[model samples]
Target chain A: MAAPPHFTGSLGYPPSSPSPRSHLHCLSPCNRAIKVSMSQNQSYWTCVTQKIEDQLKQLIPVRPPLLVYEPMHHLVFTARRTMAPALCVATCELVGGQQPISPNQALVVASALHLVQAALFTHEQLPLTDRPIPSNPETLTHHHAFAAGVELLTGDGILSFVYELLGRSDDPAGGNSERLLRVIIEIARAMGSEGMVDGQYRKMLCSVLGSEELCDVGWVDHVCEKKEGRLYACGAACGAILGGGSEEEIEKLRNYGLYVGKIHGLMLYYHNNRTGGEEKGFTDLVERCTSLALKELEGFNQGMVQTLSSLVRASFWDKC
Target chain B: MAAPPHFTGSLGYPPSSPSPRSHLHCLSPCNRAIKVSMSQNQSYWTCVTQKIEDQLKQLIPVRPPLLVYEPMHHLVFTARRTMAPALCVATCELVGGQQPISPNQALVVASALHLVQAALFTHEQLPLTDRPIPSNPETLTHHHAFAAGVELLTGDGILSFVYELLGRSDDPAGGNSERLLRVIIEIARAMGSEGMVDGQYRKMLCSVLGSEELCDVGWVDHVCEKKEGRLYACGAACGAILGGGSEEEIEKLRNYGLYVGKIHGLMLYYHNNRTGGEEKGFTDLVERCTSLALKELEGFNQGMVQTLSSLVRASFWDKC
Candidate 1:
């Protein structure tokens, strides 16, 4: 199946909200996507997404073990919004990287990010015994037999693929191996216990404890950092590393990613819980994340990072 | 809980078997452990196991996210029999390495191997939803709430840790990063779609298909190669890489690992299906694998590889 319509990089516009852009104060990403003539960055985003798609297809071919590979393919192709890869490439360009848009280090790391995300989604969707995810045939068409087993192993397989991709080096003598290793470590920690996995565990814990209140504003925000923030945070940081940014620049980008990640994560939380759209502190959270994200780019060349800045602020709907 | 009584690195003795050592003419690994006096290699094995245990603890500490970390810890600590790490260290020693047994490249790779195995076991044990593995409280003590979610996420978390561990470079300048990269790539492939995951898919397919005949001797042997063989093959090959072995030696060690892995996999299969003791082609397969594993060491110094040879041959109940 194709991507869910919302996954078109469009921040959800909650129906009950008085103003669609009240919280974010920028044009919706989906809307920006449509008015390509309005902003050149729209086309840039499109190109970056296409690059990611081509690289992903080349990296994960349709081989044997159709059971695992097909799910991995579908989940990645569908779940990917061009968000992570675009951020990676856009950051690379910002740092004046050579071959910034090519199938280079930035693109490879972004692909691995998507794969890790696919693995996370697979594990999260594990169903009850009798009720398989296949029951929602619309979501997972053709994933009938051994749905649980296939998904479980598919998640594990994709993770292995992530390391495999990262372990590769352009220089046979491994001149770039150390850089790649740093990326691997950073991404691993983000996705490992302290970051995404911990967030997931907390989220799951809330459900098991049967207390929505347990996911208080602060608690949910922390979860958001792990689940969504870390990926974006790592994506940006990894991009900076590939672009050969200085230590401070890498740190600044990572912080920037964390803020963007929070905004995206809160958006997800709001999307999932539509009824809770007008809940307290929700808008405040988004506003805080957006301003902080914008502040991080202050240290960089303003002209070089215009696209990245607009991408995070979700302002290409008009500003560009 | 401690490891199941079976994980003591002992080859299972079929009750119906005419002779305990009739098929392989060698002593069992478990028996070797008991009679440590007979073989000096037994002491080496103990030291290796202790090292793996210490590294695992250091790598996976019990801090926050106890839900995921706990399961990861339990699985690694309980399930690890020191077989994979032992093979790695033994190969490193055989290849004439300095600091071979210390916490060098070989040990790091071995630690990752055990972590990956823990992940595999976590995914493999996803229970029928209503009946959580916690129902077998003895097996998973104090793991009552959100058992499925915990296990699923725990599996993903551990896989991330594997990359995290592999990504670490002891040499600040990454002098050995190239070799580590090779080891990472090799292990990833061994556990990727065409290897362990595919084997699992086929094995699960047999059950989902509900055909005993589907898992024929040949099919099972192939399955064994993917599930068990690939891990050992990668383990030995990785050890050779860290030990600075020649390409030819690494290749041979990999083949040796393949043979040893198949033997171990078949033994697991036999143990799981105790009643299948009198089944067809079991003994012949073990005998064949034993001979093949031993032959791989012929090109090296006999004295140097005496421990490595006995490891695969399962001799030294008397031979040592």
Candidate 2:
């Protein structure tokens, strides 16, 4: 549908004085301006908006409707185009260089990205396995969804860039393409159950809720190994894949991943250690984990080292 | 004083049934076992305990004194130590590491870390630059104090680590140190006036209270630059100081800072959009600024990246 021209700034007169009763006429400036613009463009409108407005007027009868029903439809329509420019740009981007995608198609892609990002983030923020479990599923779910969405957007953006590279015929089997694929897979796996999300949930539940007698250390370790640990492995695998890394390089990347995971875990533990007594141990733990992670990253091949280092350099841990 | 010997194994008692009547007396077997152990340990206690117990007893009297304070003090002292081993460890660590560290050092550190972490997380969770200026000075003071404390701890930790590097002859050149100093000063400046805090306060007074016209676009830009943009810069600066990075490397880091700052701002905007419509945007603008400041560490290094990434990974943004 064609959009109406914006008439917001075409005021008929200057603003009136602040005193009440100074300008009963001033209140209708917008309507008057709109009427004047409409009159000037009447012939053009008759050929276009006149029919549409007539149809709309007919559809929306003069009779009073259910108050609830009226607002609901109006709200939905208003919300659908609330951020018109951004959504329009997003839609165009989604449909670019490919088949035209429906609005729903774009929305689905957006939603999937959201979910993936949420899961990754939720897992990362969870405390160490030694702590208590979180009480609320909603909070967990909310975090998971948010992280997943962000990851999806980031991955999608990267993927789009990859597609562009492919389109440009830039080294069909180049290391960059492989690295991009690996990043995608790494992100996907991390979004999976055998990654950060599950590990964090398990740790939180065990520490917060599990009875001391009932809790099993092995179970907690298993969760970390399978979930959190595996995500690190996946990330390293991706790095190796992308960089065309040797076995030694791969191993170094893997070690880096493990170090990062441990640091991540320790940070969570540090956060959870709000009781004054636990601060020293947690801080020490954070230091050890960070140092270990740095050392491991340092051991990687120059390219892999550079990549990992850059990523870390772009993060907050180095600051502290 | 030495810890009392701990009893182990069976107490030579039948399994007691859950009965309210005998609950208090159910420890008879345990008491008897303790007595037996005490008799066995009499020799071990004679030399050590005689001196210690004499001192302890001397602090008390054979009969109750008029004050009745010594016994209560001793009881509390003994009980607190016995009940909380973690507390003891913290106290020892704090005292041992002391260069005139406070008596409640552990509490201070723990509380400060938690508050800062929460502030950071909350800021990230909400939309950017959307926090309203605090209506009262008290709230402002509280936020400032918390932020200052966090900055102190984080900066101190980084400086101490750098000092260690210096001790090991791994220090960067004087030029690098000078750059670090400049970065720190810049961060302080950004956090002070011409920063997010001021921008937010101005926004609050203008919007919520209707004290002025909509904030000047320049003011908004300045606020964003300081609140969101500069925080990432601070994080990057800290990272560069820690990791041996050139000026060019630090410049590259600015992209990450910018990306995170924008995202942080957007997130806060989104949150405020959902919660309070346009008016809340003013409040959220301020809040977002503060949040950015808090999250400086989160975007600065790998460990923090992992922590924040994990959190976002778990959230609802994925669904959106």
What are the RMSD figures for all models against the true structure?
8.4, 31.2
lDDT, candidate 1, B1-320, per-residue tens: 12122233432222232221111111235344654343444545555666666777888877665656667777666553527666786677667656423236677788888888877766766664523233222235433233667777777788888888887744755367778888889888888877888887787777666565786777779988998899889888888888789999999999998888887777666555434433447667767887888888888865546556556555312111
lDDT of each: 0.68, 0.32
What range of 10 consecutive residues in model 2 chain B has the weakest lDDT sum?
Answer: B80-89
Candidate 2 per-residue lDDT, tens place, B1-320, comes to 11111111122121231211111121234334554334212211122223223333433233443222232223212220110111111222211222222212222222222222222222222221233444433233342212221222222222212212222221233223332233324333333323433434344444445543454433444544545554544444433433345555455444444434533444443333233334344444534443553354343334223322221122211112
List ranges where model 2 is wrong by over 4 Å. Answer: A1-115, A120-189, A212-233, A280-284, A298-320, B1-320
For each candidate, how many residue pairs have backbone atoms clashing (under 3 Å)?
Answer: 1, 78
Q: What's model 2's TM-score? A: 0.25
Error of 2 at A75 (Å): 21
How many clashing residue pairs are found in candidate 1?
Answer: 1
Docking class of 1: acceptable
Alpha carbon lDDT at B147, candidate 2: 26
- Please tell me which predicted candidate would have the highest lDDT against the true structure: 1
